[model samples]
Target: MLTYLVSPDDSALDHYPLLGNALAFWRSTIQQRQPFCPACRASFAEEAQPAAFLFATAAIAPTSASVSAFCMACWNDLPPAMIEREATRVLQQVIPGGRFLDPCEARR
Candidate 1:
């Protein structure tokens, strides 16, 4: 797997060389084109000022990747523990039977 960071200011073509600059190809084939808040199903079409982006490393795969976004209200109302719990819950649905390691456990 390849990992590259694309800054908001940087062009997608500049970063994803492996894609061979085929933005149209990637977009056309990509499923679930629209992103939404997992908890509230809020449409994330525009930039959310106070959003929480959760990357489920345990659920990362070529076929299925997991990213749970939470809106400002959910992010503000929920405690940190609750947020993590919810993210884990959502990820588990996407990655059934997938093992999730704690950050400390992964480090060691």
Candidate 2:
């Protein structure tokens, strides 16, 4: 399993395709002091390091409307497929016109 460290300094777009706008949205959320994992509802602390399990979805969209940001414990306990499904579901609830992206399709 691969783990991704989500930080404000790292550009989500740079790591994943079709996620530039979504990262922007997350940035805005963080700025508002509302940065929380859509799946776990765990708040993010600026000084704390949070880890996420990265996976791809099958849905095709112009932009990465949703991403699974799991806490380290959750990321370690859950399967990648399950995490992807859950993240996709949560994104649908929080974002309008959100779609899932396949990690297999990401640019190399």
Candidate 3:
């Protein structure tokens, strides 16, 4: 899993297709015919496959965050900055304003 510490001033919300919140974003992913990990763009399939993975909420602010998917390898190789921790508690709240850039749509 990966978490992002985005600045509201950075206009991070403007870059992605906002899905309201974490729950909505995840639901949208499930509706997708072939969902991919947002991090590595790996196609999500059965657990035995390398493309298998799960989702996590990225912390954007004290009251805002976004949802992201991560494949097994990508999740294990995440850098320190992307890992959720108490030090960034203020920026790690899973409140609202979650954005999701569909991997399929991203190809365009």
The candidate scoring highest on TM-score is: 1
| lDDT tens digits by residue: candidate 3, 1-108 | 234433223344456434235434544565474655555556654341222212244334234334444556655677645533222332234434333445599679
Alpha-carbon RMSD to native, per candidate? 6.4, 7.3, 14.6
* Model 3, residue pairs in steric clash: none
lDDT (Cα atoms) of all candidates against the true structure:
0.50, 0.54, 0.42
Q: TM-scores, in order shown?
A: 0.48, 0.44, 0.30
Candidate 3 structure, TM-score to reference = 0.30
Stretches of model 1 off by over 4 angstroms after superposition: 1-32, 46-50, 57-65, 97-100, 106-108
lDDT (10s digit) by residue, model 2, range 21-105: 5555655676476565555677664532346533333444433344445665556677877776766566565555665655677
Where does the lowest 10-residue lDDT sum fall in candidate 2?
Answer: 1-10
* Model 3 worst lDDT window (10 residues): 46-55
Q: Is candidate 1 or candidate 2 better by lDDT?
A: 2
- Flag the better candidate by TM-score, 2 or 3: 2
Using lDDT, give the best candidate's number: 2
Candidate 3 segments exceeding 4 Å error: 1-32, 46-68, 83-108
Q: Which is better, 2 or 3, measured by lDDT?
A: 2
